[model samples]
Target: MSKPLRALDEAALVLFSGGQDSATCLAWALARFGRVETLGFDYGQRHAVELDCRETLREGLRKQNPLWKERLGMDHTLALGALGDISETALTRNAEITMEKDGLPNTFVPGRNIIFLTFAAALAARRGIRHIVTGVCETDYSGYPDCRDDTIKAVQVALNLGMDSRYVLHTPLMWIDKAETWKLAEELGGPALVSLINQESHTCYLGDRGTMHPWGHGCGECPACALRRAGWEEYVAEKARA
Candidate 1:
């Protein structure tokens, strides 16, 4: 059997973007660790509105569960990068984010996750924390090569070796699909997970605020939308069957 996670005493630095997967990971971190600090990157993506949503979610969590914030330790930091101006990817550029093509999509920011994780790790190390959590998943990711499990493992090794510290990189959603991710949120048992995902998270490049879309924002025809829709369907089906 797999070993249970070690009794984590130090705070967990979560690389949160206030999106569905990241939000789920945040909830999981809140339950698993003694403290949780969230970090969001203003990586100049097409949908900048998500950052606003992230702030709202963070504030809501703080107000709703004051004890969790006080006892478990909750905080957030914003990092700014010129990803939109420098990167030619669809997520950063004006191109359409699609799934018809194979391999990595135009939406893939070359070293986006690596850069984000590196920053998070550095923050953790500085704060005397050893655990860093991210929500990257290979199972249902948007053809982003950086989100692969192997990539995360490689990054973990590098972080430890470079920092010469006992840092642990946690990818709670690494092996699971989006459906399983939603299940994880359900298991956490709080409006913090489902409600935040439904109302606050932003997955759209166009920044559509319309509720007509099933998942949340953006045109539902895109690749991100399709993955989200499929996951939601599976989650609802599983919940109904149960």
Candidate 2:
């Protein structure tokens, strides 16, 4: 990874959910910005255990590198039970996880990313953070519209205009597949980061942590588990080939 380029004043606040993608984005920010803070939302997600995963991941990250320890800053979590109250998707409820008739996965929560970003921006403004980092991706999954590059870009524009501040929203995994996401964690922080991600991060929609897979701990049945497992296999395969 390149040396930190941005100064402390140009710190970044990552929308961290303790999931694979969000954790990767946190690492990405820590490797570039001189200071990085994390923000998580508690929207009453079925996988709410992910909020607990944040602690171990952050401690693991701090131990991986002294630079990261120096750069990692505060962490925050907001109560967003209101989002769950209005949504009946698979993630917020015990409903069956499946593809809906609308061609999108039932896991899609309405205005999730948008609301997260807006809240992040508000928190950033209060904390004097100049940039926001997120893990929203469109490569491996296409079920969520808010994860699209255009949506992120549009949100960035609107946030800047509304807040009257130049807030840069960085999407490090925007174009990368899940496999490449694993590769990125490896590139940013080497084996320690990879190990931390595999063991500490939570991505299962059902919040399964009882069974451990090669990729990590998950139910190995949900769409999230399948994607992570496939990506880990591909990433390992390519490494073996190399």
Please tell me which predicted candidate would have the highest TM-score against the true structure: 2
Q: After superposition, how far is residue 17 of candidate 2 from its true place, in Å?
A: 0.4
lDDT by residue (152-227, candidate 2, tens digit) is 9999999999989999988888889999999999989998899899999999999998998899999999999999
Query: How does model 2 score by TM-score?
Result: 0.96
* Candidate 2 RMSD to the correct structure: 1.8
Q: Tell me the lDDT of model 1 at 79.
A: 52
Q: What is the lDDT of candidate 1?
A: 0.75
List, residue by residue over 133-225, the lDDT tens digit for candidate 1. 899988787767888889998998998999898888888888899888878877764645676676778776666667545556667766777
Collision pairs in model 2:
none
What are the clash counts of all predictions, listed in order? 0, 0
* Alpha-carbon deviation at 108 in model 2, angstroms: 0.4
Q: Each candidate: what lDDT?
A: 0.75, 0.92
